[model samples]
Target: MPRANEPGRTVSSRLWDLLFAFDPNNTELTLADLVRRTGMPHATARRLTLELVEAGALERTSDNRFAIGLPLWRLGTLAPRAETLRRAAQPFVEDLYTALRQHVQLAVLQGDQAVIIERLSAVNAVGLTSQIGGQLPLHCSGVGKVLLSHSTPAFIDDVLAGRLRRFTPRTIVDPAELRGQLASCRSTGTVVVKEELSEGAESVATRIVDGRGKVVAALSVVVAAGSIKLQAAVPSLVASGLGLSRSLGWRPGIPIRTS
Candidate 1:
């Protein structure tokens, strides 16, 4: 296999390597940080970094670190999956946030993880590290479970057979138990998670289907554990999910398709 800095690597690939080094956790980085993260030589890293800054793909912070620029974010908004789903689910997500005064999020499956596309959060709600672009574990998170349940059987099997990380003691790591949970999730179109992903956090999630009844995304409401009655939020959460699904052309009697 070729190394990242091998002579065969293209310039565009090197540039992308630098950009990809910045993520939800490492959102800002210094030139040295980029060099180490991308495994590029200091001079080459600096040159590409400067070029990206000139091209408005990255911006320098007051502390002399680099972060993704506005133009780059604007370009990401053009992606059909994130923008279309976010726009269609905005109103319903807002209503849920207002009613529950908790964290309301919309997420879609991306590979083995669930990526949060949009989120509305309350000031006093549970302190969560994940943001709009952050990812959640498929085997533990409420939205993750909903999306995973509606995924293809082969894909679901791969996830269940893989190493499931135990975030909390309550996290269901056993494949047999999780299989049961996914079965229930598919039958009911929703799942309730209690402190599986994070201690003192609980969530309830429902699938968001499209016109063809393909589960396109998952909508979830997360609250501090024991802060509010989870059951009370279920009706509103499912209703908002259905309302968003309807906006996407889904209707009654359409058989849900596994993606």
Candidate 2:
């Protein structure tokens, strides 16, 4: 593999390295920070960062830091998968939020992780680590489990072969046990998680399918542990997921496809 500052590296690759340095946790960074994070020379980092700012892909902040700019954000919103799913799931998500007054989220599988495409949360709902565009671990989170349950066997095997982080004591790190849970989730189209990802958060999730019966996304509602009956939330969550699926052309007779 080429080093970060290898002479043969392309300008676009360097620019991408700088941009990819900014993530959910480190959303803002100074020029020096970018240089350190990208392992690029100070001059190279500064030049590319300035070019990005000039191109409206990044913006400088009052404190001399940089953040993702509106133009780049607008470009991300144009992603067909997330945008279309969000639009189709909006009404159902809103209804679920109003009916349950909890944290509702819609997520899609991106590689081995579940990326939240849309989310609605009540002011007093349980605290959560994920936000829109944030990711969740497939073995531990409710939405992650639902998405993982419908994934291809090879993909599932690969994910299981990787290291599974134990976020909490309740998180299922044993591949065999987790695999059994996934099998049940695949059969039922829903899974209830209790403080598996976060200490005080519990979630109920269901799969969302599309016209070809492909499992495209997962819809979930998160609440404080033991605050409300997890089972009670299932009906509404599953209904909302099914409703969103129907809007995307899924029907009763269509067999669910795993990708």
Instruction: Please write out the lDDT profile of model 2 over residues 65-115, one tens digit for every residue.
Output: 999999998998899889978988899999999999999999999988999
Q: Whole-model Cα lDDT per candidate?
A: 0.94, 0.92
Worst 10 residues of 1 by lDDT: 1-10
TM-score of each candidate structure, all chains considered together: 0.94, 0.95
Per-residue lDDT tens digits of candidate 1, residues 159-200? Answer: 999999999999999999999999999999999999999999
- Clashes counted in candidate 2 amount to 0
Query: What lDDT would candidate 1 get against the real structure?
Result: 0.94
